[model samples]
Target: MSHDAAMSVQHPQDIDQGHVVARYVSNERRYLKLLGGGFLRLGEAERAAFIAALRADALQVSPEEIGALLGYEWRSRLTAAWLVGVARRIEWRERVGELLLASELTYAGQGYCFALAQFGGKNDAEILVSYLDRYLPHLECRYDQGLALGALLRLDSRLGTSHAERFAVRDGLWERWVDALPHTRGTADAWADASRSRIDAWCNLWDA
Candidate 1:
């Protein structure tokens, strides 16, 4: 059966209940065409439907399709990154890291790297840190370097003293965190206030 036909066979109720495998398959196939064809006028209901479909099984996105998306323009890459953010599969996380590290598409690569850092574990952290140590100086944007720094921080938080001292000495990252603090809005008002206090405490400890 045709892709759209198959997707049509899936009950909308099934989609609402979180059965989105078929929908994702159909969407992936149509992504390029949808964009190129200028079908950007999806109504609220359709848009909501699409987002629900995406969230239902983002982790199931195949490596090949992910690779294909990495090759898309920056906007599409951002969409792919959002999908990765919702993904729960470790294998997909590994594949995302591999693609980001190897890709020449810098925009997508940066987004993928961020997603990997957000979702990845010790090995992903180690690989990313090693890559940053070697390549960060060559990166043009301070923002991009900051993202790598954030990833390192997340990793360090999990690894503790095993890697914290190493990160503490990374002047570029430490400086950037200091620079970024005033600009961060935090996760929410209460959480932001608490985080600010915690950060202040950490700063005080560093001074000591």
Candidate 2:
């Protein structure tokens, strides 16, 4: 399927019982779908409206629908994670943590990190620390290490923990991540600095 067609896939009614059958592409799922791309391209006013709608829509999604979204392809999974985070659906926290550790898909980890950071609890920090433990040793895997670390630090500040310090020490996991970056970006702290910005952007999405 074309990229556009794939983005607009029909979400079957089987995925969302109780809700009337209709084209998901034309409904609130579109906001969930836009979490993948179109949402970021809007002007500031439109973006604000879009973000509001997404949060509102998230409140209306059933647990069954969230489970189905998480089980779908990357885009839907990303959307589900974002919705879970925005809605502060604490019940799904562990499930999101499991997906983060699994690293099953490409872009979905970004959403998982966002959700965990939004949860802002010790459990979320522990999950990120575990992820770093598993992946930082494998430098070549170059996955969501930066985002995960940044989210950990964000949680650390909020929850009064220092989970990220060991990783940022000289020649440590942070350095390993930086080394894996492209040759043009070789500064020791470049990755760490960039990570903060990325996590901040995700966290600040709903801020005043």
TM-score of each: 0.49, 0.82
Tens-digit lDDT string for candidate 2 (90-142) = 89998888777878777778889988998888989999999999888886676
lDDT of each: 0.46, 0.74
Question: Which pairs of residues clash in candidate 1, taking residues 3 or more apart in a chain or in different chains?
Answer: none
Cα displacement (Å) at residue 103, model 1: 5.7
Candidate 1 residue spans exceeding 4 A from truth: 1-53, 57-64, 139-143, 161-164, 170-208
User: Listing every candidate in turn, what is its Cα RMSD in Å to the true structure after a full C-alpha superposition?
Assistant: 13.3, 5.5
**Model 2 misplacement above 4 A:** 1-41, 181-185
lDDT of 1: 0.46
Clashes of each: 0, 0
**lDDT score for residue 41 of model 1:** 52
